[model samples]
Target: MLVISSSCKLCCMSKSLTAWLSIGLLVALTNNAVSQTSHPNIVLIYADDLGYGDTSCYGATAVATPHIDRIASEGIRFTDGHAPAATCTPSRYAMLTGQYAWRQQGTGIAKGDASAIIQPGRVTLASMLHDAGYKTGVVGKWHLGLGPAEGADWNGKIAPGPLEIGFDYCFLIPATGDRVPCVYVENHHVVDLDPDDPIHVSFKTKVGNEPTGAENPDLLKMHPSHGHDRTIVNGISRIGYMTGGHRARWVDEEMADRITSKAVAYIEENKDDPFFLFFSLHDIHVPRVPHPRFVGTTAMGPRGDAIAQTDWCTGEILAALDRLNLTDNTIVLFTSDNGPVVDDGYQDEAAEKLGDHQPAGPLRGGKYSSFEGGTRVPFVLRWPAKVKANQTSDALVCQIDLLHSFATLTGQTLAAEAGPDSHNLMAALLGEDSQGRDHLVQQARTLSLRQGDWKYLEPGRGPAINKNTNTEVGVAPQAQLYNLRADLGEQKNLADQHPQRVDKMKATLGRVRSESSSR
Candidate 1:
């Protein structure tokens, strides 16, 4: 009887021990899974004036974009991707803030010397990501204005630029390549700004003896077809005025390499931990200065060469990822600030040399227009281990979705005021299903909405602002509706036939904008 009792006790002890061991093993496995699937290193590569069809994956017949194509080949390519605005500054605002650019006034295309557009204490993607234990940095074009709350004193000190807006470090052009104060701004101060040769800038009035593009077409190498006539630097006239900063002036051809190197260095330095790098490339934009190596390499002249340079820059970034062995773990996203515009300012023969090349793909307008091409752009996401290879999706995602999507991926939730207009697009971006936001507010200054195959343009009085390129900007007296699935060109305005559809869309837009406003 004693032996039997002892045997029973031993059996019970062994069962208990086995159960505890199983629990410990399960916990270990759960922790490992969480660590493996948790927050990914995010690298957002944004292009300036890059069109939807410019990339081969987006259906570029004339120009091949193999490096850009690699991104799509490896991950998912979103067909219904869009920028938040039709122009650079507004789109950038939406990208960083996750709120519609038009939500805030004075968030249009900023000149080189415009007062700081981003509010000082406002939440931004960079700031949010940084707060979540990710190192943040931006390299290349920062068209978002710099300086103080009131105005900037170029001679005194530059403050409250990228650093104020959540970036741990910034290497940026003060504005666009075709705008003035034509110099690089590293962190706060303008690079090589001579104390004696104080940089003077004015968008309203011309300053000093600098020859203007309007006055001297003879001296101009790249002629202006439209509104890009101002202070000429390196034989190209920019939009604003600048008297000095000759020593700090940047050569346009070398821009791609300069920014690429900075981006790669940032990655190499921060590869041990999670990082977010906003690699904004100034390519194929105005002042189309392709390096001598890439000059005359394409049938599209400097514009084509610029495209090649942009692709080359992509290749270099990919190489950096490969070298660091972060290719599998990193989540890289590629998109543009806005759509395409050939004759934006400089006469680069982007229009004349065009031989059966469709920059805007099958979309209607380009830059600063209320048409599909103006804001809709190529969006590609690549994550090797997590996302499947060679997938395409028709996800209705926007740049504004980045904040919430990242938050969702990292097991974080955003408050209502923060990521106000953002929606999580993890499944859509990963090519799980094309289903995404039921309705999206497309912008060209006013509001438009896209729901499935149908797109509605709000009735307005202004002419589509893209006069130089002659792309339609969706300005009409009556509400406009188009079935994008059937009419990708957006030629057939079905407002008369689709009155109920238009009404329903207007209601959806009203709800979204109103709800956003309430927040």
Candidate 2:
């Protein structure tokens, strides 16, 4: 209107274009920020051989698990939580892979030299989180095997392990505390080693010059109760034989502190970014050696003392979250790999000095059984930002359901064929609804089915009680059934009384097993 020049008009037009471009960039960035909000940091704390009645939150009076109990009090606790299997390796296999461990031929209680049970490139819980823009790590007992079927080279690089599966970092016990090479494997190699003294291992034969527990009873501080009399390390015998790598052997009593320190460090490093940490605790398991600091925290001897130590580890993890200022955005899940066992393979006074300490509580049997105590374990979850504080749910959730459930929480969709056995129970997990697993298959030597408060056990051929463990195997010649609502201890055989319910459950279990996948 004021008779502007062409050059001035072109300048104004360019400035207007720049303003619009800035607005577009801002909108795109805002969308990206919004998308990232759903992916919260997740920490899955798995305890080894912990039972439903082991924690004070679950009504154990022998020892109080304040740290573990806090998760139940602050977020949500499930009364009927279970592992996929009664033993460690199979249960861990099912938990990570979201497939029944029995589906695979080799998924048993793995030896120290056993190869990788979980094949790589398959979607695991860690891999799923990795794909969802989270850094993943696993610390502590990794008994699900490592390397190839031919076995791992203790001195050489260990492959096909946690790293190959999904984790960005792994500080593992390799097989277990009672297994051999008796060394810590961080990522792909032993944590500390002297090349001059290379390690050798074999589960099938005695491969070392080291004195066996069978031969060196005088040298042992804790004698083997049964099968664990192969290799001697730190005055204790393990299940597998190993020679050399003497410098790399771990001290049983110091394991809790050493493992917890590494886990805390991981949280510190990943505080700024979303991460998924699988902190597996080797606590209250066999060779029940509690840290000296927590030596006699309970009246029930080493097993109870170990429980106290386990609680300490839980407290350490929580403290890390708070120190890093990640508590509000972090979700912590606490559960065990399997049920309880008093005397698995060691003479740790776990069975002898059991003075009113109920590790299995109201459950029928302990570890290595088809009963409720075998698979049922303590489970608690906490996330202050998303989950309301101090809530409890009696949802019948299983560890196998975590893979799909977490995917949902992060707004991710698993492939239709993947996570076949996993159910999306996020609403149940968060206490948003009471709906949980309609049914879950419990595995021991045989399989059983649980649907709501009813359960059916198949007739099997096994010892009524395992002599070494002295645990009732829940085995019988007849089909056993129970209404858990009426018989929480699983005493009464209601199968003869309720035939139709047994038929329906038995049929459902058959289909679940016969199918290629549960999905």
Candidate 3:
């Protein structure tokens, strides 16, 4: 009821408006800070033994990889991407450790019962991401070995494994499909294992009363062409011997479905928080047994059918991201451990059914070789929030650089001793830079060097071609050089013509080998 002046009322109204504007400004600033600081979820889909031309996006007309193609179409398809080595174990080791496998002894292809290759307390990609407040998980092939030097206790807890190395959770295939103790290791224990049955495995000698493929040829549904003829499990011959864990043994055909389901579930579980999933797929490798539904999906036999199954697994992961509305803020990377091999061990009609299909495309070698086709694989990166769609990159990118690249992405500073060989190629990885590593070393039976468009293969003593798999080994008594720009197939040897360049490259390789750290 007290009368007030018009000027006083106006002043009161102005002050109230200023208070609301200040609150609004503070909220807007807080939201901006969160948007800038929030990290993206990362999903690395690693394909085992998948070649440059295995996917439809990479020019594989024989087999259609629609899901893989969708990733490439939606993001960047790299034409000059590579694994660290031509072999599985070394490639995986280098990728995770950020150090070349050759730098350490006993880093070669590990046996089924081998101890953990990656020691505890080492700062790995998973560990680095985990420190940045991300839930890291790994599912499928973990060929880097497990447990201690004495070996893993199949019935008890398996220590110094993925859990110790920074992965919050792990569902491992133990080794490869063609190897044994062919059971899934969930974190510390063997999945579905019966306590009474126990478990025993040996690579040095046969164990248990299980019939071997060598002794029970009549019982095998798939016969080995070479060294994978020891233990027989699920009607297929394996490399190592294993006994017990009968209920824990996985069905080969159902592996894709089982592992894919686990990967999807991990994504769903961690939807509220930033997560990193290493979806390591085991497909198109030896003993290529696709699910019954995908058996006849491809005309290229079991090998092609396995590729189709791999595509389905990729699709499942993409669908999970979509379902959770996490597509935009997730980084999906699709690449292979190494190049392809048609006849690794089992007689799966991979070679016989391969008509005009070129697994490595125009490249010379596959799997175990120093050639372009060996380490160079299909690489695609999709991030709807950052990367533009339908782009192609020829920048020389290698998997070994991912550790440092991701560290940079998460704004984490790596210790000087950590990730010694890993380069910060985040610019190249995000497609912001056109050039990646200036020089890269490719490992096979012999080490090779790639500098710009030139390739140098050091002199080594070995067979030029693998007789068992019929793949070119790329070994020679003298140094070999090639100008990859002019000769993509590596048909012409330019070492004799470019002796100076060869000598320079040789010196560089020598230096890298002698040095403790490349970064």
Ranking by lDDT: 3, 2, 1
User: Could you say which candidate leads in TM-score?
Assistant: 3
Give me the runs in candidate 3 sitting further than 4 Å from their true place. 1-38
lDDT of 1 by residue, 187-238 (tens): 7777777777778888888899898888887788888888888888888888
Tens-digit per-residue lDDT, 14-126, candidate 2: 99999999999999988855654578789999998999999999999889899999988989988888899999999999999889998889999988888898889999999
Q: What C-alpha lDDT do the candidate models reach, one value each? A: 0.85, 0.89, 0.92
Model 3 Cα lDDT, one tens digit per residue, 1-519:
998899999999999999999999999988855553457899999999999889999899999999999999999999999999999999998999899999988889989878899998998999999999999999999999898999999999988799998999999998899999989999999999999998999888889889999999999999998988888889998998889999999999999999999999999999999899999999978789999999998899999999999999999999999999999879999999999899998888999999999999889999998999999999999988888999999899999999999898888999998988999998887889888999999999999999989999999997899999999989999999999999999999999998999989999999999999999
Q: Candidate 2: how many backbone clashes?
A: 0
TM-score (all chains, Cα) for each model: 0.92, 0.94, 0.96
Model 2 spans > 4 angstroms off: 1-37
Q: How many angstroms is residue 238 displaced in model 2 relative to the true structure, after the best TM-score fit?
A: 1.0
Error of 2 at 302 (Å): 1.0
| Candidate 1: segments with Cα more than 4 A from true spot | 1-33, 517-519
Q: Pick the lDDT winner.
A: 3
